[model samples]
Target: MIPELCDQRIRQFINGSDFVLAMNEDNHVFSWGDNHCGQCGRKATPFRVYLKPEVISDLNDKNITHICCGFKHSLALTTDGQVYGWGSYYEQYQNAEGSDTRVINSCENHYKSFFEELSDNPIGSGGFGTVFKVRHRFDEHIYAVKRIHKEDEIKNHMEVKNLVKVRSKYVVQYYNSWTEGIILYIQMELCEYNLQNILEVKLQVFGRQLGEAMDSVEYLISCEIFRQVLESVQYLHELNPQIIHRDLKPENILITLGKAMDCVEYLISCEIFRQILESVQYLHEMNPQIIHRDLKPENILIAENIRNGRFVKLCDFGLATVHDKRVHYRTTQKHTADVGDMRYIAPEVSQGGKYGHKCDIYSLALIGGNIFEIDLFNLELEDTNVYSELYQILNEPVYRLQTILISMFRTRLWHRRPECSEVLSEYNEWSIDRNILANDTRFDGILSILQSNDNHLFIELSAIGSGGFGTVFKVKHRFEEHIYAIKRVEIKDESEEYLQRFYNEVKNLIKVRSEYCVQYYNSWTEGNILYIHMELCEHNLQNILEVKQQVFDRKLGKAMDCVEYLISCEIFRQILESVQYLHEMNPQIIHRDLKPEN
Candidate 1:
């Protein structure tokens, strides 16, 4: 960090032909540019770049009036009629020179001494970012360096901040950042191929055969590339800051050159997509979360040099943010960035709404459309005897993608969009079991289930019943049809008595294995909500007693009083047997709360 200088305001800033100068609100002149000739008005380490802007407090006693910039020179005019000049004063060569800039003799840098001299290894340049190729002298390892220019520093601070923290096979590896004046040098792995290259080649080669001859082999490369893209995107979205590749296009993706060829590369692949879906799941399950505002075919990179040309790398973080998920939707809406790729941007984002990580799902949907060569925006909407341009343009991509992408998309709404993790487990051909759900060992008993770390799988329904210890609500797995009774106990500031009671119940449940007792499934905790999901019964003994009191009022109590007595006896006998089963265990257990409500 450049110490975050936003609190101060610049009165006026002017870059001299050789050096730069700016006055702040404090009437202070801050200088830090080409200081090759001591024109910066400050002493600095030889051959060292002034990474941070420095204040020139020497002119504090003088009321500065005018500033001038000349070729390789600078001048300052003060209100006292005093003039000063410093910079290249070589008048003879000024007209015959090929350049005004010159490098002075300097001592070697201890850090860079191990590396070879700088070569004009410029890779590419564009409005957003530029790449340069650099190699170590000893190891001869090549690295792709990003040159972040001055004006664009604000736009790239987040990128540099994020890239350095990421560690993943799918994401471009970040090495280190070297600061020099207003520019930043980001070192990273170099990959020559990107998904855009593959996509373009596919379109060019399979252009005519796309509609008619679409086969497994025809989509193998596309499928593999897509899978890897998902994995990288997932990895980024899962970071602590929950990175979002705000600008995801093929160009941002970097690749290696393995140059390996195999027939498996031409086969329809699930492994590639599997890695992506799982990675997304991990990110969605995080606390604050992430949302990649921009995603398109261009952001996906193909590394033909690595893993037989089967790897993918995700890049670009200019617009990404480590969002506070707890922030109000209105607050998020007000603070949202207006930058994104229009074609792949979620409609809600384009329409300006506060959204969560699911925005990436919408972008992913657009990517899916592109991969399938489907023009999502052209799809026909259901007609009510009329047509709306906005209606078709927005709904088309969503509707065409729902069948393929699996997660439900409320094209017009933000909250209604399906979660990123849910899609991986519930839909995609590369879908896997929800690892959280699969970890049965973690849910030992009712209390263990109630103390679950977080709740994402369950959708709490209406209150069904209550006991002395907790309230039971009927809840359903958000993606499944099965319903369960979730016993919720407020854990915040919970007394030891309640804790012991809950743990005792857990012990009893764990010790007593039976078909008669309610089955325990899972439990998790979030904030003050301590919850456990278990088998939901139609009625407890209390409900039975109340219904029987009315003499066959409810559906189940239609039996005669005598028959009901037998049923009651059977229920009591089963409860007693459950207690006996606990007593017989090596560590005897007891249901102290054996009342009708219990």
Candidate 2:
């Protein structure tokens, strides 16, 4: 067996003869062994000793996303899309320092004075100091002012640095930060409602509904919130420093309304949820990686009257830190930081055992469970024993899907936990197949659009194909004992006129059954999502063609554009028969779109 390397924190490294360089998850390049030519992005002096891991501060603001160490020179790729070089420069390292600045005009409409507030009741205050809602005089745009006390300056500089570095819709934006000797003033985007307040409101209104299954509306709302939080954390992990929000609680996040939604299109929330999962999926798949040690309900923000909470964002990076994301398995050494929320902290994190991104996954699972039970938002539990709720979440069957998700976080064992991407995939899917199944299930090999016992009757598996209109998934029905492909078509417009056309097409599809054509088994619509089940084929034409190409290459010693004469003849014959069958219908049916996939 290969031995595991102790250098788990290094994102990537390059070895060279004279010197060896390593870049950590924090995006700081560490050079050691030898630095004969100042290849480590540092100044050379007569008594300079080239040794252990030292940060290349010049590339700090650039937020270097990637790095490449050359024999005589090194390249630092920043997140801003600019490339900085150091070492045996093409002009001595291309001066990777202040070259990043592109000066703006003398008088930009940016928030310059956050210190001066028109009306100061003060919005909120904490260890960071008081925050007040402020408006710029020139632009007349409203902004939030976070006034940090003078004593906290030296200690909180890193947090200030992170705010200025990151720019994301989910994360609160930073406008300007300044120090006036005694105090530090920061101008940032204003969030009207904090997540903690929103959670309380949500619980107060929807607490009674916990016993019943969440409707499409509630599911979509929760999903959107979950997605944004994961995405924001993912963004922080991808940064050069690979930040982890150690204090991810709802009180830290803020929400704003961006758009207005009408009464008709609540299903559009489906799209919003997908966008969130995609962003988070990108985060879990990062190299060095990021794990938010603090992931609780308080960190999740929801926008009010904004498309029914469509535009949510994650905020608060107070206890955020750049950790060694490269480390996978827990180390023998214990981490004794009381950083995260007590209820949501992963066992590994709580026990001081070394952990990774899965810790964030655990926290998110707890948050999801708490949100489902409405226990996460209720302020009454703040003074009461929260452990009972955590215990119930662990033992009770209140959240079936959440129980499955929370299983990952029950122990300190890293191998037991699911990745963020996996959780996102399963959660984003429609799990209320039972409700749909209750409506119908009279069909055969094509499982009924919705069988009476849908959960037991059929299982929707992996995706087969995707198109502009819909996506197709490979599925199997337990009763039918046959594999089938189901197409989930998106309803473009919710009107009888458009729906009638779909019904007519389905009616036509059902009647013209033939050996030469794909056998259509079922068709149905539930809400906006549509389903069309059909017979599963051995292979698609593309796969068949590729296999045939490989065979021809071996036998004939040359690649052929088309298949063999006899095989091509059979394919053409089948195609013609299918076309003929379609044409012979009552009113000749014409397929406007025809390709290998079809």
Candidate 3:
């Protein structure tokens, strides 16, 4: 029988066998069944039977909408929007004095009295117990109230202990829990919709039925969501407790809908990407490795306020466990199987071997694949090997989405994927390259020069600067009346080897066309002297710095501003950009002597 309850229009159903289930108006599960082991407090009977139904005393006056049930545990939500749970699952595992084999009745007296004093407003539920939304009796501050069953008090206590030790932006915050009579209550940060709800929304917005009118803004928003999720997971994995959200799924993730609805469209800008990358980098640097066994879109949450949207948090750590380096490697050799979601499980995890953090990497890739519409799951393998297919996907240039997805899906447990640091590095490199390519015009101009063979502007000029590799000269083009700086080198230095080197540098510089980078103009050679003409600037960055030391006062401030402005300018940006580009290029070039001066 289905029973409707709560102001939010929550409904409950007692299945044929006697299990009671509650659901919110949105149709999300709120609570289900009896906690004999404190698995269901309100429905306790001397003997545990599937058909018996009992109403929770605390829930009878309120409307509860959704519930989540974990192994031997249950959570409940009221229509008045208050959340509560009376189950022994968490307590039994957590309480130090609790015995593992104790029967259901030993905790009934303790359970009956725990439901008395709680201000209502239902939020959600989890495996261990129910979480309620509550406003402080005095301050009206919102909080998540978790009700743990007496039977499961030991487990609940242990979870709380672990929660206290974990500190990370990605993991949900745990406040405090106390017992009044029979019910145990835990208060935490109040969250909105779970990841499942958000995904449903995204699915609707992107589905074929949505047609061509699918907004780019929405696509961008989704990308931001994906980025935030990764960052949160990365953070959790880097914690001191090294927490992993083993049950990461859509239902576990909670989004602040009110925040999302109020956020402006442009809030997910480049700055947001920067913050995301920075956070990822921070997590990778943390000590003691953390690996998330479960990583899917559902485990990642999005906070309200788009610019502030980076509050993507990872939730649901019921199955999380800590592992050291030795333990981690040993587990892979032992062929342990507890790892991830089926669709996102890495091949190694599926093979039932020792898997490490790469499992998380694989799942992250799946999330990306889903969001970007990349067919990573069905991609044609380069060979019979899945790893080869993954590599090929990473190398593919046309579909950036596929490349990122494949990179995250490395098939081998060891060589199959990059560590969090590597993943973060690659992302930064990509972002930097993208930004440089988008704003710089130097490459376009150089291409124009290469395309034209006109020799009308070539002319001899006086020397400007000299170095071991080449000499620069102030030159004026005869036809265009343009003043340019030219670098002259011996013919031997202009040979194919040197020419290739020069071209590489030019290519690197072109890629970074920032205002601070020395601009390339044109190139040619006269007999033994090879010449390269470039844009003429009065001072280089080093020259300006020297000027700053000698000329203090208002000029110093101006000089500093000039230096900062130039560094931020397209030219200087290109300089640093070129350095990074060359560093990652084929064979990996190193700028051996980087300093204030060349």
Candidate 4:
């Protein structure tokens, strides 16, 4: 077998009268076998036979969608409607006036011949150029075409270089780029809305407040969007001579709806098959990390039109930097100091100090705080005071989402900030831990039993008791109509000894099935909180003592009498028997604080 043929993944194969043609998944055309009458689409030789497959270089210029063969010729149809033919028939008109010239001319400006601007007005514009929505004439698929003026060639070329080098689904897809006279054109995958637009719309819906707390659904969506953004940035960082998007803000991120192309192309009339999406992966592994000096909300884009699921795409690599790890650190002396947005720029960058990839993490910290509606600290303030304020905010109770941000908010202490991978790993751990309470099937029984008549589950009717370990709440199971005392405990940050003691209490409840002991129902843990469901008693010993004293005063008008003494003696006897039951066990269990409250 031909080594090249073996390496290429052939998507389609065909046979001509004296030759064979194959189109690979990448849309590159290859030919083997007989080369008679130029049917092989290669240099015509005297022998007219080729055992090894050779790729047709001309067809590679276009995205050949389909290929077919005639008796002594082969034809290729490009995505742009242009048809290419080779072999004896084309040789007949090789010397015809303008026929050969026309073919050469068509290949010269393939971009112009295939794509046309959909509208006169550009969809987006920046310092380098205006971006227009264009449609491929043959495929009729829409794309974004950025037209950059020659005056901004440096920035435009840098962006093109980075976009072409990085191949990631989270990053905006790059197609083709070319120079025409004084303008440079770049074709890219089209996306609908940027994060800036999404946040503005959300702000309007939430009473136009900047720090308005996002509801549960909105919070989850924000987490997903932010996670994708992190993934894209991580991709840049992972690249050797890492790419740093010095400009990462909400305006640069785009969003669009998922495509239904799979359904449109399906031939079978089955619902299950129609839901599948075209499989493609754009992952590339490399050494080092990229620094996006200007990392903020405006640089992120979201695509809703994806077949699998909607995701955010990173764009505008104009301010990105390919930082080589050999250099160790980068100083702002060679670059413009005021290039990034003032609000999102890291302290080191703004202060003209040496900086590195952690700058992006600092920006991420601020963006994360904004996403969770946490108050944004004053960036211009002294690092000491700012960190102090943050410390105070963290001292109190906070959402797990906000806690992750703390590790990224080292501010002036850039080294303390965690890398993108570390931060993402921690965030994923927290997310999975919390999800167990709701999604794990093992907790379904406890969850179902905790439901109450109110809209919320696990509603506490009353606090029946309290101790060092946890609190006991009087609750009623909605479906079972059974009242149960549920003990809620905070196990987070507790010592191993404390945890072991708590588990011992639970074990004792389970093992001792005596009538004197409280009945244990169920137990479960959610995140840091531990819960135990037990039988709810109507009254404790203290309540009984007070009630008996009141009855005696009303009836006999005196203190304790002979009959009252006998009643007290019986209560004492039961307490002794309960203690005796514990002592009888091989490994005795002790009630350390045996009082009326117990």
All candidates' lDDT scores? Answer: 0.57, 0.58, 0.53, 0.64
Provide the lDDT at 282 for model 3. Answer: 45
Let me know the TM-score candidate 1 reaches against the reference structure.
0.26
Per-residue lDDT of candidate 2, residues 559-587 (tens digit): 44545767878887888888888888778
Highest TM-score model number:
4
Worst 10 residues of 1 by lDDT: 259-268
lDDT of 2: 0.58
Top candidate when judged by lDDT against the true structure: 4
Q: Give candidate 1 regions above 4 Å deviation.
A: 1-121, 204-212, 259-598
Q: What's the residue-level lDDT of 263 in candidate 2?
A: 12
**Which ranges in model 3 have alpha carbons more than 4 Å from their true place?**
1-121, 205-215, 257-598
lDDT of 2 at 400: 38
Candidate rank order under TM-score: 4, 2, 1, 3
Give the per-residue lDDT digits (tens) of candidate 1, residues 386-433: 211222332333333334453333254556666656555544332222
lDDT of 3 by residue, 177-243 (tens): 4455567666666675676765555544333254554333345556777888898888777775577
**Cα error of candidate 3 at position 88, Å:** 32
Clashes of each: 14, 8, 69, 33
**TM-score for each prediction?**
0.26, 0.30, 0.25, 0.33
